[model samples]
Target: MSEARADIYARITNEIVAAMEAGAGEWNMPWRHDGSSVARPVNLISRKPYRGINTLALWIAAHAKGYGDGVWATYRQWVERGAKVRRGEKAATVVFWKQIRGRIQETIDEADVFDVDDGRPRFVARGYAVFNRAQVDGYEEPDAPRLPESERVAHAESFFTALGIPVAYGASGAWYRVSEDRIYMPDFGRFAEPTGFYSTLAHECAHATGASHRLDRDFSRRFTKQAVAAEELVAELTAAMILADLGLAAHPRADHAAYLSSWLELLENDRRAIFTAASKAQAAADWMHARQRASAAQKESEAA
Candidate 1:
């Protein structure tokens, strides 16, 4: 690896260590819920990545208090209520919401939502919001605009290389790096713009972070539903942070809806998940930033 790349990797590693030391425990995996005892092929939208019990409990409390729409406020309320229940101060209750065309509508359903008085009040739901019911709309564009092809490839290559991950172009805008010399990048024609290209590459880089030689996350092992959610949460947040640092707007994709339950559940289950994910994401951003900086320094050094 080039000295510049090496420096980038070191900087990223340092940032990660510092973030972890600062009590970044929110990355803990979440629980998963299958609708039935028999495992079936579940689509992304229907798949519940977090444990049903914990999630249901949270849903009930939040629903009863009518606090799902506001992201930060809902999270804060859940944490406060969750602590009460955990400490035997309040009980859990399940409040059912009607399912209307993939959207979770607040309704009275005895089977869907119920309350259980265990230590604290706990609420459970069979399922929360479905697709198309809740939409994420914002003032900013969903994705960053495209960049020049050459710039995209150069950026992707430099970004991964700095992390010590060798990636080459592959078909359909995909990227892969199995070994030191074996790396691939997909054809750019597969994507309409550079933002998509970089976003896809960023996802792959996140996977590389878990490589045996690196963070060794071992995603292959069947993670508790929560753990997988947590990792994905880390990946998404990291990608967004990196994208923002790169002077690009990180737009939410359609698939993000698939993890809504898990996201909410993880946050509710662990009050620290948001901060932890943010810190890790910041670490990833620092990593990418350091790499770019190193590259610039090397160019200046050569000029000097």
Candidate 2:
């Protein structure tokens, strides 16, 4: 990578690392799920979700400020929408890929190549500032917490159902049966707390993502403290992410909290472990979305 590109990557990764370190100390991190909505931070300008590292960056910012809504906009974008940022509200930094002018190293014919390794092509990350809707006025928030509990559960059930995993209730513990390719949980009624049932289910779902056909997360070298800890960390991160996607609180429970020391040890030993775990967790979430999109396409095909 070019020095410029290396700086961009290092800068983003370092910021995330710093946030995680700070949150771990304060217990103010996303793991606290606390039912805070992790809805996509949409750009008021385009109504499109921010991508890649920007998503995590904005999420950290919103959670830090206790922003009620995930809506965001550049200063100009808010103005264009006839909304104004409240004075003194701070802005969060985000970045996007911008292409520099000029193309390079294209061969006009199959036989025409001079060694053109020195040619320059420029694509770099450009930074900008945005304010969450909580910092703005004159525009109504789009995502109000209006979904009722029963309805919310219904939606959650439907979304997981599409993953096509068989979930069987009635076992001593909640777990994914890897050998049988099934999930087992204690009866739903046994979960006394409101979020317990969904949280347990989400954890199992994350484990299922490691099956041969999905993310293939090999935890085969188990029995060691580190191996088990790493797998648990992945599932914890995965459940938290999916819960956020479901607009539910994602705080850590006893199970997720139990491994804090292990998690911190692993992270302290390797600076990139958290990022690797996050990327893998995202792949698990993407697997669910892939099923969702395919199901939609099939329905359309049948309708047509």
Candidate 3:
């Protein structure tokens, strides 16, 4: 990587590390946000949610700056929309991965030359500056429509049911047993708050996605402390993404603080660690969504 690219990685990683440290005492990660403006950070024009590291980066920026919404856009995009970024308002950096397009020359028998294509496209990170809606004028942040608590709970239930992951309730603790390919949780009434049940379920379900038959995202082969911490971070971030998509809040679990030190160590040691974890978490969340859609389609087909 070039010096500039390295700087981009280090800068974002440092900021995230700082955010995590700041929140460790309170047990709130950067991604745990109130479902106010929208579930996830989105472009003001494209209406598409930001994914992976960009999602966590924007969430940190929004939290630090006390932004009331998750709408974001480039300066040019804001100007094109006739919205003025307020004077002296700084921008946050979001990285985009662009593929390097070219081929390499290879010699054969010292007589012939061939241009051989690389097996896979190589991607380089580029940073872009974007301002949140709170930093702009002449545009109003839209109110996010919310479902009633009961309906939202039912929606979560239906979503998990569609995925069809087996759940064994009435357990003393919550976890996904990869050995048995099942999840165990206490009964519904045991949770202090209804949202807690769903949030914990999302976390466990994210772990289930890492099963051999699912996303196959096992980091346990290393059998080291850091590896375990990395997998936990992936599951935590994936759960945040899932809850955000469901338009629900991610309440912090009291036990999450145990992994905070390891997470900080990982991020500080390798600048790209956060990026890799975010990518894996995003992939897991995407897999869950795809499975849900496939299941829903199958059900519709059967009904028809």
Error of 3 at 43 (Å): 55
Residue-level lDDT tens digits of model 3 in 13-86: 34444557666553322222234334689887888888999998998898786565678899999998888998
After superposing candidate 3, which stretches have Cα over 4 Å from the reference? 1-18, 26-152, 220-225, 250-262
Q: Write the per-residue lDDT of candidate 1 for residues 30-117, one digit (tens) a residue.
A: 1111222122212223233334453455454434542222121122233332311122223333224333333333434335433332
Tell me the TM-score of model 2: 0.48
Q: Across residues 148-190, which tens digit of lDDT does each residue of candidate 2 receive?
A: 4443377677778888898886443466878999997655544
What local lDDT score does residue 117 receive in model 2, on the 0 to 100 scale?
43
Clashes of each: 35, 4, 0
Candidate 3's TM-score reads 0.51
Estimated TM-score for each candidate = 0.40, 0.48, 0.51
User: Which ten residues in a row are the worst by lDDT in model 1?
Assistant: 131-140
Superposed by TM-score, candidate 3 places the C-alpha of residue 269 at a distance from the truth, in angstroms, of: 2.8
Worst 10 residues of 3 by lDDT: 28-37
Ranking of models by lDDT: 3, 2, 1
lDDT of 1 at 8: 41
